[model samples]
Every structure is written in C-alpha cells, then in structure tokens.
Target: MTDRSDAHTATTPLAGRRVLVTGGTTGIGRAIAVLLASEGAKVFVCGRDAQHLDDALARIREVGEGDGITIDLAEEENVARLFEAATGYLGGLDIAVVNAARGAEGLTDMSEADLRYTIGSNFTAYLLSAQHAAKAMGAHGENATGQGDIVLIGSMSAYVLGKESTVYAGIKYGIQGFAIALRRELGKKGVRVSLVEPGLTGSDMVEGTSEEQAERIDKEEMLRAEDIAVGVHYLLTQPRRAVVQQVTISPRMQDEE
Candidate 1:
C-alpha cells in the first residue's frame, strides 16, 4: 500500500494489508508476524515444525490476528503447497517476507548434504517463494496504486567473512543476488522486491552457545528480532512509487569484521 508514517511508527503503514511470512514460527519471522498483525494485517506464517508453528500461531492470536502453517521449505513441492495454502488463507498475497533460513556447519565440517540443505532451505526457497508471490500478487492486477511487495530477509554475513560462517554466508549472499535480479525483472510488473539484511539477532539458532561466548559476543548489543520486523513493515508500507532496494540493520554496538 503506502507508507506515510515516520520512524516512530513505521509499522503503522501496514494496516489492513495481507502478508505471508516463511519460517515465522520463531525468531525474526515470528517478530515480523506479531508486528505486522498489530498494525492491522492479516498475517500468515509457515514453518517446518508443527509444534513451533502452533505455538507461534497462539502467540500471534494472543497479540493480534494471524494464522500459521507447517511446511518444510527445503522441499520444492512443500514450498508450492505453502504458497497455495497461504494465498487461500490470506485471501490473496499482497506481501511476502522470505525469512526461511538454515545454517551450515563450518567449512571443514561441510558436506554435500550440508551444502544442499543450506542452499535449498535458504536461497532456493526464496527464489521459489518469490516466483510464487509474484504470480499471486500480479494476478490481483494492481491495487488502487498498482503495486505489491516481496521482501527477502538476508544477512550481514552475506558479505562478511567469518571462520565458521562460509557456507551460511554463501547462501545469504546468493539471496542478495537473487533479490536484486528479481527486483529488476519484476519492477515492470508493479511488484517491488526488496532485501532486508539484519545482523546478529537473538534467536534459537544461537541457543547452543555458552553464556560466556554469548556475553563475549555481546548478544545484548545485537539487533533484536523485533527491530528487523519493524524494517520489514517499513519497506512493505512504501507507496507504489517508492522502492527501498535493500536495508541492513545491526546493533549499534556491534563491530563489523
């Protein structure tokens, strides 16, 4: 639709919109769902874990209006099913948040399975989801303003180098390229594609870390999942005439390596 608000309430712009978020059962996706619903959106979320999906749905219901589905993005057929189900649930997809991601172990520990799983779950999923979202949003013709949005959640690791993050970085980097190319191709169709890159957010993905390491890394100073959700709302709320190509958010206190 249109984003008319300032920084104080960027999410207010998403009111009355229909949005679908992948991997929304926890972490950043869950935060995006909650914030979008609070802003008056009919949000739909998907995740592979049924229990997690149910929990996320309950939490969203408690806070606002939304639904959740269980589907593994790694499976192409499942990805298709998710879009179909989400379209029906949301009454038509107006916005898509591609947040599904999986981590790969260190480069030394990497195997064919790890590489395939990483790419399949992260990069490939976004490509497929964007393909589906573009079709669904384009099918709606144009809103009164003639536009829709597809936001891909990328990572700072996409461009950075970390000893153990090589494979994961590759996936995130691939997503960046995917979003940029997709945006160019879809611009004529009035479906804007954007990339949101958030750095170091607190989530279950890092739950395995020790408290000492967590402190050393200063998780407290890292970007919060809700913060990225705010960014997603901002990008989607922009007027049809405006497009935010990409946004990178990190904790002010975190140093770039």
Candidate 2:
C-alpha cells in the first residue's frame, strides 16, 4: 500500500489541531490517530494495555506529537481522568474520537461481568468522555475556532444484522441514537457531533476469523481501517456551517442493505 502521511498532510485540513482518541492503540482508532497526527494534529490516545499503548505512542511519535495513557474505560475514574489528561497534553481539545469498545462473549448466556464490561467500555465510555470534551472545548473563549468536533465510531451492524453479534449491534444502535441527540444539544455551542459507522474492517476485531477469511476481507470483502479514518477526517474538517451527522462506509464488494 502507498504511504498516506505526506499525501494527507499536503491535502487535508487537520494541521495543528489537538485531538483525543480512545481505544486508539489498535484497529480503526489507531488508523485515525496516526493519520491525524501525520497531518499535524497533536494527538493523545488511550487503551487498556500499557504495552500496546507504548507501541502505539512509538509509532505516533515517529509521525507527529502524541502521547498515550493506559486506561480501562470501564472504570469511572479512568473515564473521568482521560479527557483531563488528554486536554492537558494537547493544551486544549479540538477533536474527540470515541472509538473504544469491547465485545461481550456471545450475545446469549453472557455473565454479569461480561455485560457490565461491554456496556461500560462500548456505550457509557463514549458518553462520559464526550461530556468532558464539551466542557474543555467551551473553555476555548469567544473567538474559538468553532467549539470543536466529536466523532463517534459506530458500526455497520447498527443497520445490518451480523449473526451472533446482536449485543454489539445493540450498543452501536444506541450509539447512533446518542449521536443524534448529542448533535441537537452540542450544535448550539458550535460543536458538531458526527458518527462514522464502519463495515467489516481488517483489525483485531476481524482477526478472529480464519486466515483465509481475513485475506479475503483485506483484499475484496471489507473496508480497511484507513478508509474509516477518512470518514472521520471528513466529519472533523468540513465547513463549520455544515453538520455531517453521520457517514457509513463499507467495502465496494459488500452488498448494500
């Protein structure tokens, strides 16, 4: 694949922006974080694993300014602290990408622990972080460059049925609803809320499949992480007057609903 760093820098509008991405150590969040950093955005990312956080930061630092913290979003304290730390590092907040989610092991027969963890990580985390984002951006003063942007990473499963993935789908469905409601409230403050729902993408989430299945998805069956990043960038960079409520992206080979 061709390197997108230089091309993205020369072409798009994310330079000098301060961004925070949750669950950004891998998968779609990683792609968005790295791409934004390469385009001159000071980014901060967080994940559950310290080792993965280190690895991601190394890659991000090679491209542009960035930092990472190991946070279990399910924990209330961590969720509260994340935005404050990220904003402190970036000096302020211009963009927040809500992309962290943990799947429950099978929809049926889930234990209480599985349900709590999944709900905390996938659903509640986004809401609490966005709340902090609103406060941070509001502090940007009267002449602030728009209040900022909140981009939620949803899933195509919100609209399409994925066998045995109903619990995950339900969380995404709630996210879509939350994103809509958020837009209604935040737009008055000059903050735009947008949702990017991605179809099957080649990431750790998709890695559970067989190798041949993964190859097919990478080559012809599904979208790539960078593709979803493109959608997120568009949402953040669009004219302040225009509010892009949501964008759904999928591989060309994936049949439409």
Candidate 3:
C-alpha cells in the first residue's frame, strides 16, 4: 500500500519542478499557486488583470520566488507571449495547471457577445494554454524521472444539471474531451495529462449566487479552493510509474439530484 502521509510531508516532493499556472491570480488558481510553491516548485502564474496579477505576484513572492505575467489567454499572440515569458523566467516547464475560466450568468438572457466572450475565455484559453505548455514541456524532454505532468482544472458542472449553465457546462465538457485525447497523445512522450473536477467550491464564481440559493447549495459542505489544491498536489506528486488520469472531488454531503 502506498503511504499517502509520506507523500505530502513538508520535505518538498516538488522541490525542483518548474511549474506554470494559468488564471493563477485569484480563486482556485491562486490557492493552487500557493500550495505548489509551499511544496517548493518554482511556480510561474499568469492572469489578464494587471492589478490582480500584481497582487498575486506579491503574495506568491511572500511564499517563494516565481514569475507572474499578465496576458489574455484568448489571444493567440498573448498565449505565445505567456509561454515565452515562462520559458525565460523559469528556464523550462515541468508542470502546468490550467485553472482559468469565466462563469457566464443567465444563459436564456445572455447575448451572443457574452456567449462568445465566455467560450473564448473559459474554453479556448485552456486549449491555447495547454498547447503552449505541451510544447514547452516537450522541449525540456522528460526529467531524470521521465515524467511531465499537466493538471487541467475542470468543473463538476460539466456533468451536473444547472440553470444558466449551458456555456459553462459545454466548455467544461470540451475540456474533459481534450484531456482524454491529450493524455493518449502525450502518454508515449512521458507527459501525463489529467483533469481535476471540483463541485461548487466557494470562490469568486459563486459570488453570483444568491445568499439563500448558495446556502441551500450548502456551500459550507462544498470543497474549498485549498481542497482542490491538495488534489492538484496529489496528482502531480505521483511516482513516474503511475498516473492519476482524473480526479473528481465533491463535498461529502453533496447529493446528485
């Protein structure tokens, strides 16, 4: 039996790993950045908002030294620039956490403009980031341990039924498909791709919910940002011989209806 306790002891299983996290300035992405840095990975994070990016960079620096960049992932050129920045700052990449996404409100009332922006930010951005991350990690070759890992943050909403979630679910489902296909393609190259799905976590995304509705959802019972961070750490820390292809985490009290 594998000892999970030893796996997360403070000795830093990620000591020398070079990592990049998209949407790393807030919410789940920010939590992930902090956790990865605590484990000693040299972490680079990016976001589109300059003020938030600066704040996140300052907080992350308090934890450890890592680079942060401001880029709109929906733009191909910006995506390319992000990769270049990470390469220059970190020298190379070993792990990538794709955690950026936007929540669209009111599907029935949403404009086409809203739909386009939502998909572009949530779905296209993830694909673009992954493409660049794969290229960067591929260039680095496998580490001495012969493993490269990518963790894509997905949503339980992809599979759950919800009002006004048409675009969000669609994009998340697309990410699931992308992860499976990417894993198949990269497996041979020693790059393991996986998805992390968390249910109704408390974050900026949930602020849109009404107090009554949010309480009924039992947000307290739902997974926290750091909870998902622990999952990310677990997925990346596995021995080279093993791969956790997908992880679905929900509140123990969460019931599917």
By summed lDDT, the worst window of 10 consecutive residues in model 1 runs over: 138-147
Candidate 1: residue 200 Cα off by (Å): 0.7
Residue 151 lDDT (model 1): 91
Candidate RMSDs in Å, in order, are: 4.3, 5.3, 4.2
For model 2, where is the 10-residue window of minimal lDDT? Answer: 138-147
Cα lDDT for residue 49, model 2? 87
Candidate 1 on 1-257: residue-level lDDT in tens?
Answer: 67655644423267778899999999899999988888788999998889999999998888778987888889869888998899898898889999988767877797888788878998778888888888888633343223578899999998777888888887788888888898888887788889999987877776445464357446556666888998887787766777899999988877778
lDDT of 2 by residue, 85-152 (tens): 99888999989999998765557768888888899989988888888888888823444434788999
Q: Which whole-number lDDT from 0 to 100 does residue 169 have in model 1?
A: 86
TM-score top scorer: 2
Tens-digit per-residue lDDT, 68-92, candidate 3 = 9887776658878888998789998
By TM-score, the candidates rank as: 2, 1, 3
Q: State every prediction's TM-score relative to the real structure.
A: 0.87, 0.88, 0.86
TM-score of 1: 0.87
